[model samples]
Target: MPAKLTILTNGSIKVEGDFEVCDPQGGVFNVAGKPAVFLCRCGQSAKKPFCDGAHKTCGFTSEVKASA
Candidate 1:
């Protein structure tokens, strides 16, 4: 299945299905067979590009909605 990226309101980006995550240096980060993944957007997660639930404490906010 193709991957889908969903931008959450006031939260991280939710990625579902098959996907590939890579670093700026062209190194791929292993997903370990996860069907879905949550990416950090608040820039507060100790795990960059992956949500660590830091938005709650960091006061990240967004009102944007996902469209079909």
Candidate 2:
């Protein structure tokens, strides 16, 4: 699938396969850098880049796909 990037409804960005998530403090976040990760968009997640289901409680929804 060449590493899929899916933006779910009222949820974080679903990232699969291979990628890198670097913190603002110059730190790389990776739990072995193998498992799939969900990045937060609503900014209400307790797990920072990872989603903690806080988007649902904040009524967040994103489904806009820009065409290239």
Candidate 3:
């Protein structure tokens, strides 16, 4: 399936389908064999690029909508 990215309000970016997460040096994140993953947006996640539900207590606030 094609990858789909959903930006959650005041939270992480929910990712589904086939995709890959990599760093600048081309080191890839281990999302292998997983159906879905949540990427951090609040920067409060102890898991770095991945969300650890830290936004719930970090006082983060954001609500974005796509525009075309």
Structural similarity to truth (TM-score) of each candidate? 0.89, 0.76, 0.92
Using lDDT as the measure, the top candidate is: 3
Sort the candidates on TM-score, descending order.
3, 1, 2
| Model 3, CA-based lDDT | 0.95
lDDT, candidate 2, residue 41? Answer: 87
Local accuracy of candidate 1 as per-residue lDDT tens digits, 1-68 = 89899999999999988789989999999996898899999999999989999999898999986569
Off by over 4 Å in 3: none
- Model 1 lDDT-worst window of ten: 58-67
Top TM-score prediction, candidate number: 3
The digit string of per-residue lDDT tens for model 2 on 1-68 reads 46788888768888887777788898988657466888898999999878898999897877767689
Q: List the residue pairs that clash in candidate 1.
A: none
How would you encode candidate 3's per-residue C-alpha lDDT over 1-68 as one tens digit per residue? 99999999999999999899999999999999989999999998989899999999999999899999
What lDDT would candidate 1 get against the real structure? Answer: 0.91
Q: Candidate 1: how large is its RMSD?
A: 1.6
**Which portions of model 1 show Cα errors greater than 4 Å?**
66-68
- How many steric clashes between backbone atoms does each model show? 0, 0, 0
* Greater-TM-score candidate between 2 and 3: 3
How high a TM-score does candidate 3 get? 0.92
